[model samples]
Structure formats: C-alpha cells, structure tokens
Target chain A: MKVTILGCYSATPRTFTNPTSQVLEVRNHLFLIDCGEGTQVQLRKYKIKFSRIKHIFISHLHGDHFFGLPGLISTFRLLGRESELHIYGPKGIKEAVTLFLKLGDSWTNYPLIFHELESKDTELLFEDDSVSVSTIPLDHRVYTNGFLFKEKPAPRKLDVKATTKHNIDRSQFNNIKNGANGKTANGVEVANQKLTLDPPNPKSYAFCSDTAYNETILPLIENVDVLYHESTFLESESRLCQKTKHATAKQAAQIAHKAQVGNLILGHYSTRYKSIDLFKEEALEVFPRVALADDGKSFDI
Target chain B: MKVTILGCYSATPRTFTNPTSQVLEVRNHLFLIDCGEGTQVQLRKYKIKFSRIKHIFISHLHGDHFFGLPGLISTFRLLGRESELHIYGPKGIKEAVTLFLKLGDSWTNYPLIFHELESKDTELLFEDDSVSVSTIPLDHRVYTNGFLFKEKPAPRKLDVKATTKHNIDRSQFNNIKNGANGKTANGVEVANQKLTLDPPNPKSYAFCSDTAYNETILPLIENVDVLYHESTFLESESRLCQKTKHATAKQAAQIAHKAQVGNLILGHYSTRYKSIDLFKEEALEVFPRVALADDGKSFDI
Candidate 1:
C-alpha cells in the first residue's frame, strides 16, 4: 500500500501550504481522503491520474476538508469522463454539492452516487473481496469521522514439493490453496497444513484528523500498520488545541503510544509555526516511530 | 484604469492555465470579475492583495466563472477580515453560497451582502461619486450579464494659469472646477471652459464574456476606452460557436469594429488551441487595435 500527501496544513490554504487532502492506493483502489481547496491543482502537479479516483471519502464538512470536491467533480465532466463515481461523506454533503451544481447548471454526465454518513459509532463504510473500510467516530466541534483501511488476508500458498510428494493431482491444487485437504489417487487424505503454508500478514492504515485528544478511538486503530493523526499545534499552544478541539503533537504521540501502532504519521500543522521540526521533537518524547507528513510526499507501507 | 488578467482560459483549470477570472482596478476600487476555480492561488501568485478587493461581480452561474467564490469568502473569514463584502451575481447565488457555508458551519464574521440580479435590460449595478457600473445584458445559454465600468468625469481640472489670468478669486476656484462660471473681484464673469479644461475624457472599461455573437451590447459599450470580449473559438470553429452560445475571434473583432471602442481585448480562449496568437491575428484582421489577454498580464486604459 502507498499513500500520497497532497496537502496537510490547517485552516486555509496559503502561498506555500495547502489544506487537508490525501490519496491512498491500496488493494488496487485509489481512494481520495479529505479533498481541500487547490487539491485538483496539486493532483496535476503530482501527476496523479484524475480518472483513477473512483471513490472519495470525506471526514467532515469543514471547508478546508471538502471545498475542492465541487471543482474536482466539474473538472471530471469537462474532461468527458464516463465512469461512475462514488462519494462517502457527511449527511449534508449531497444537499450542498447538489445546490452548487444546480445553480451552475453543471450536472455530471456520469453516474454520481453519494453515501451520506451519519453513524456515531464505528461502522463499516466500504468492503470488497480484498479490502475493507470502517469509520472511527471522533470528537470535534462538528460531526466527524476517521477512516480505517485494512487489506484482507490472501489465500494460503501451496507447497509444491510437499503437494507433489503426497501425490496430489494438479487439479487439486486449487482446493489445497483454499485451506482444504488434498486426496491422492489411492484415496489417502493429505492434511491441509502439510500441503500449504500460511500467507503473509495483511496491512492496515488509519487516518484521524480535526479532533481533540481522545482515547475512544484507540481500540479501533489498535495495531494498525500506519496511523496518521493530526497535530495542529505544539505543546506550547495546547490551550489553543483545547479551545479549538484540535490535537497537539504531544496528544497525538500519546494516542499513538497507547494504540501501539507500527508507525505514527503527524500532519495538519498550523501555519503559525515557522518550522515543523518542533512537532516531531515533541512527539518523539512519547512515540519514537513517528514521521512528519508533508505535501507531495509519498509513503510506502 | 488598469486591468489584470488572473485567468482567461475557457472551461477547466489545468496545471498551467486557469479558468475565467480577472481583477480590474478603477477609481480606487479593486473589482474581481468572474472568479473561477484556483483564483485565490492565482491571486497570491500574482501578489494581489486580498483585502483590497471589496466587490466581486460574477458574469454568470457557470462553474468556471464562480466556483472559487465560496473558498475565497471562507478564507477571508479565516484571515479575520472585518470589512463588508458585496457580491453581485445571478439570482441563485445567495442560496448556493449560503447552503455551502451552512453545511460547514463556517459563517463569516464579516457582513456579506449579495445583490442578486435577474434583469434582461441594461441597469446600473453600482455607482458612487467618482465611478458607476452598469450591466450589459448578453445572449447566452444561461442568465448572464456583462459589466461596464465608467469613471465619472472628474471635477473639471483647474486651468491654474487661465484662472490666474482671469483674476479669479481663490475661493471661487471650487465653483469653477464644478463647471460653474467664476466671478472675478470686480464682478466680471469668466466662462467655465476658460477657467478649466474639460476633465480628461472619462475612461471606461466594458467586460463581456461567455456570450454569443450578438450586437445588442454595442450601444452600451460603444466608445469605451477598453472592451474585453470573449473569443472562445477561432473562425474555423464558428459552427461550434453557434452551437455552444459562444463567440469566435472574428465575431469579437466585428463587435469591436462596430462599437468603435478605443482598444479591443480578446480572452477566454479554448484550451484546445495550441497558440493564442491566432486569436490576436484573426481579431486584428477586422480591428486595428487588438490585445490578447494572458494570465498575469496587465493592461492600462
């Protein structure tokens, strides 16, 4: 799995920094998360194929989180796209987007579907044969959610030498890979464990942002391969974090340490700070495996 | 009067080119016309002060014309702007913008006033002591209007030498500048023309875009100092122009010639064209003075 950060600044986009938005590539699906303003231009700058974005997941209704959605959808129509697109966002997303498109008389030519989310509990949002996505309810000024993406376990690998030694026919290889016992021509049974080996562990990623420091999401994001959390301010400005319902670097580290995730990624830095190194330094006090998220940066998990 | 082209291309914004948007500086007011997507970034890139903009005039409801408005308004709030902003656009603008802001719960602290328009006849949209703006109804697929900004004749300039020779009292200078006859100390009447030369011919700028090849607007824009007309296609694609309700380069030139404007500016070129010089060349065939509008290019009238 690979994730690309298109933008990660807080509040409004500026001359050199962008708002919250990212693209995650997992299980052959390219999913867009939290499309902020100027995301389309950033996508062009990063050379991400616009058509590859089949599904979009918005965390909340903040302007910095979803202001770019309407423009992106209009660009798709202008580019003559025909593929169906699915959008998963908050309840009022459809109404807001529909009103804007209706006023402009710019309806899409393709099938556009919206999956409005209103659940306040951890619930499944999307699922396929190889991947599944669920929401992590978060505490904020408005209704918001974090997303958890996990890859499904693959089929067991076949042990060719062991299968051949057991006189298993080639036609029975499919059954062995499916975790079933293989039978020889003589009607002797071969145990499934003897004929195949366990597959590698599946990978998982979690994204949390625009939320206060809360331990309620720890259970849902526990043991994730990579966890991205918003650190809008430093410990020095923790008071602002409390007032705005945003997280500081120290709080984000505490959450990562409690969840025991493999790696922690910090993003959504406030523009007030001249340097981002302070966030990492503050986070390192609690969690050693922490990385900074920067625009146009790519991570491999 | 000075005009700056923020984005002049038709349809969608690309990696290098932007959609329809411009900044006109006339009579101490920085008026933004047709804010397309990514306009805020373009404004920052061109170093246009955000606070200097007090009025925004949208030509139509097309996404390419006004998609960036909501984000721009939200940014103003984030920057702690306290001044009132006036937006002039089609009737549905208020509902559309209000819905988007309401969904995000991001209401602006500044007073936002909207002047919704649905008139089919020429009407004055804005006016003050020094400048006046009127709408030029245009033929298009949607309810659209072009704007004509005219600088009111300045208080007639005082011909200091002539006034002194006429022995006019200093206190009567104000009356002479106001186009009144001046009285000398001996009760001699001095003609207004002799006391003051006619204020430099009031400069005017007409902005017409996203319209078909119609001559109805010529009377409203006639003899203007500078006229900006949309040329979305070349003469070869004139057929497409009729089908799309757009004007060709030749058509724009024809209007300029008939209207007898001081200078003709061509913009809103289709992205399919490889060279914009073709538009200037074709327009120059019908009009002698023609200028091409490019992003970041400025014009002084």
Candidate 2:
C-alpha cells in the first residue's frame, strides 16, 4: 500500500500549504480522498495519473474537502474521459456538484455516479475480490465519514517441493491453493497444510480527519497497518479541539495507541503553528510510532 | 491601471500554468475577474491582498472561469472577514454558490451580495465616484458577459501656475477643477481651460473572454485604453473556433483593430500550443501594439 499526501493543511489553501487531499493506492486501485481546492494542480505536480482514479471519497461537505470535485469532474470531461467516475461523499454533495454543472450547462459526457453517505453507522461502501472499503463514522462539526481500506486475504501459496514429493496431480494445484487436501498417486490422502504454505499477510489503512477525540472509532480501525489521523493542533491548544471539532496531536496519538495500529500518520495541520515538528514532538509523548504528513509527501506500507 | 494575470491559460489548471483569473486594480479598488480554480493560491503567490478584493466579476459560469469562487468565499469566512462582498455573474450563480455553502453549513459572517445578470445588452454593474464597471455582452457557449472597467473622467487637474496667476481663491479650487470659470485678481473672468488642464485621459480596460468572434461588443469597448481578449486558438486551429465558441488570435486582433483600442492584450490560449509567443505573432499580423498575457505577468495600462 502506498499513500500520497497531496495536501495536509487545515481550513484553507495558501501559497505554500494546501488543504486536505490524498491518494491511496492499494490492490491496483487509486482512491482519491478529500479533494481540497487546488487538488488538480497538486495531482499534476505529483505526476499522478488522473485517468487511473476511478473512485473519489469525500469526508464531508466542507469546501476544503470537496470544493475541487466540480472542477476535477469538469477537467475530466474536457480531457474526454470515457470511463465512469464514482464519488462517495456526504448526502448534500450531489446537489452541490450537479447544481454547478447545470448552471454552467456543462454536463459530463461520461457517467457520474454519486454515492451519498448519510449513515451514522459504519457501513460497507465497496468490496471486490481483492479488497474492501468501509466507513469509519467520525465525530466532527458536520456529518463525516473516514474510509478504511483493507486488502482481502490472498489464496495460500503452493509448496512446490512438498507437492511434488506427495505426487499431487497437477490438476489438483488449484484445489490445494484453495486449502483443499490433495490425493497422492497411491491414493493416500494428504493434508492441505503439507502441500501448501501460508500466504503473506494482507495490508490495511484507515483515514480519519476533521474529527474530535472520539474513541468509538477504535473498534472500526483496530490493528490497521497505517492510520492517518487529523492533528490540527498540539497538546498546548487541546482546549480548542472540542469547539472546533478537531483533534490535537496528543489526542490523535491517544486514539492511535488505543486502536493499536501499526503506525500513526499525522496530518491536517493548522497553519498557525510556526513548525510541524512541534506536532510530532507532542504526539510522541503518547504514541511511540508517529509520522508527520506534509504536502507532496508519500509513504510506503 | 495595473492588471495582474493570475492565470490566463484556457480549459484546465495544471502544474506551472493556471486557468482564467485576473486581478484588475483600478481607482484604488482591487477587482477580481474570472476566478478559476487555484486562484486563491495564485493570489497569495502574486502577493495580492485578499481583503482588498471587495468585488468579484465572473465572466461566465464555465468551470475555468468561476470554479474558485466558492473556495475563496469560504476562505473569507475562515479568515473572519467583516466587510461585505459583492459578486456579479450570471443569473444562476447565486444558487450555485449558496448551495455548496448550505451543504457544508458554513455561511459567511459578512454580507455576500450577488448581482445576477441575464442581459443581452450593455448594462452598468457597479459605479462609484472614480470608476464604473459595466457588462459587455459576449457570445459564448453559455450566457456570458465580459467586464469593462473605466476610470470616470477625474476632476480636471488644477494648473497651479495658471490658477495662481488668475488669482483663483483656494475656496474656488473645487469649482475650478469642476470646470468653472475662475475670477482674476483684477476682477476679470478667466477661461476654465486656462485655469485647469484636463486630467490624464481616463484609463479604461475591457476584458473579453471565452467568446466567439462577435462584433456586438464593439460599441461597448470601443476606444478602451486596453482590451484583453481571449485568443483560445491560433489561425491554424481557426476551424475549431466555430464549434468551441472561442476566438483565434487573428479574430481577437481583428476585433481590437475595428474597436480602435489603444492596445490589445491576448490571453486564454489553449494548452495545445507549444508557445504563447505564437499567439502574439499571429495577433501582430492584424494589429500593432499587441501584448501577450501570461500567468504572474502584470500589465500597466
């Protein structure tokens, strides 16, 4: 899994910092998350393939999160995109997006499918043979949902030397990979574990932003390989988190600790601070594994 | 008048280039014209004061023209703006902008007034003591209008030497500047022209973009000091102009020539061209004193 942070600042886009937007690549799919203003330009700066993004997930209806969607959709049309685009966002996103398109009289030639999310409960949003995506309901000023991407367990790998010694028929290779027992040439039953080896462990990532310190999400994101949590402030300003519905670095670290994730990625930094190194410093007090997210930065997990 | 080109390229935003957006400074007012996506960042990069922009004129509803508006408005709110903002655009722009704000439940604290236009004829959109802005109807894919910014003829400057020689009292200075006759010390009436000289010829700038070759705007923009016209294509691609509702550099130059504009500024070049110098080269064929508009470039008119 690879995660690219297109923008990680909070509230507004500026000359040097941008608002929230990221790209998560897993199992051959490039999922765009929270497309803030100027995301298209950032995508260009990062040299990401625009055509490869088939699905976009918006956390909320805030301008910093979804303001770029209309422009992006319009650009796709201008570039003559033929594949359908799927948008998963808040309930009111459809009206907000379609209204502008209608006003401009510039409807897309390609299909635009909006998956409006209003559910307060954790719900499965997408699933395929290799991967699955679901919502992690978050507590924010508005209705918001962070996404959880998890790769499905792969089929068992064949122990070629063990299989050959067992005289397993080549036709039974498929069955063996499916954890089925294979018969030897002497008609003796062989255990499935004797012919097959365990496959590599699956990877997972959870993205949460614009949320307060809420522990209810722990169960939903438990043991994820990487967790990107919003750290809009440090412990010094933890007092402001409640009113703003944002999380401080220490709060995010506490949540990550409770969830027992492999590592925690901190992002959505407020521009008020002089340095983001302070955020990492504050988060380290609660969580041992902490990484800071900056614009144009990428991580491999 | 100083005009800053934030992003003059056509179609979509990209790395190292932008879409349609400009800052026109006239009569101490910083007016934002056609705020395409990424305009706020461009404004910051170009060091234009965001708070000074009280008025924004959107030429059309096309994404390339006005997609950045909502994000900008949101930024104003986040920055705790107290001054009112005025937006002049198409009839449906109000609905399109308000819908997204409503979706996010993020209403501006400052008053946001919209002057929705659906006129096919020239009409004044804003007027003050020093400057007046009006709409110059243009033919484009949608209902569109370019803006005309004119410095209302300033009070004739006092010829200090002549005024003192005519013994014009300081109390009569206002009257003298207003073109009234000044009384001489010997009680002789002095000609107004002798006491006051005409103020620097009123500076005028006409911005016409995203339009086809249309002659209807000639009367509205005739004799303007500067004409910034869209030259989306070159003569080589003039064949595409008819269907795209855009103009070639030659077409823009022809309009500039017929209108007798002081100078023609060509912008909104399609990204298909390798160099914008070709646009200037093509326009100079039909008209002299032509300048090319580039992102981050400024023109003093």
Tens digits of lDDT, candidate 1, B194-243: 89877778899999998999898989999999999999999999989877
Q: Fraction of native contacts in model 2?
A: 0.92
Measured with C-alpha atoms, the lDDT of residue B23 in candidate 2 is 96
Per-residue lDDT of B38-124 in model 2, one digit per residue for the tens? 999999898888899999999999999999999999999998999999999999999999998998899999999999999898899
DockQ of each: 0.68, 0.89
lDDT of 2 by residue, A1-301 (tens): 8999999999999988888999999988999999999999899899999899999999999999989999999999998999989999989888889989998898999999999999999989889998899999999999999999999998889999998898889999998888899999899999998898887899999999989999999999999999999999988888999898999999999999999999999999999999999999999999999999999999997
Interface RMSD of each: 1.2, 0.7
Which one is best on DockQ? 2
Give the deviation of candidate 1 from the true structure as CA RMSD. 1.8
Model 1 segments beyond 4 Å from truth? A161-169, A183-188, B169-171, B183-187
Candidate 1 lDDT, A1-301, residue by residue in tens: 8999999999887778899999999978999999998899899999999899999999999889998899899888989999989999999999988888888788999989999999999889899999999999988888899999999998889999998899999999887888889999899998999998878889999999889998999999999999999999998999897678999999999999999999999999999999998999999999999999999999998
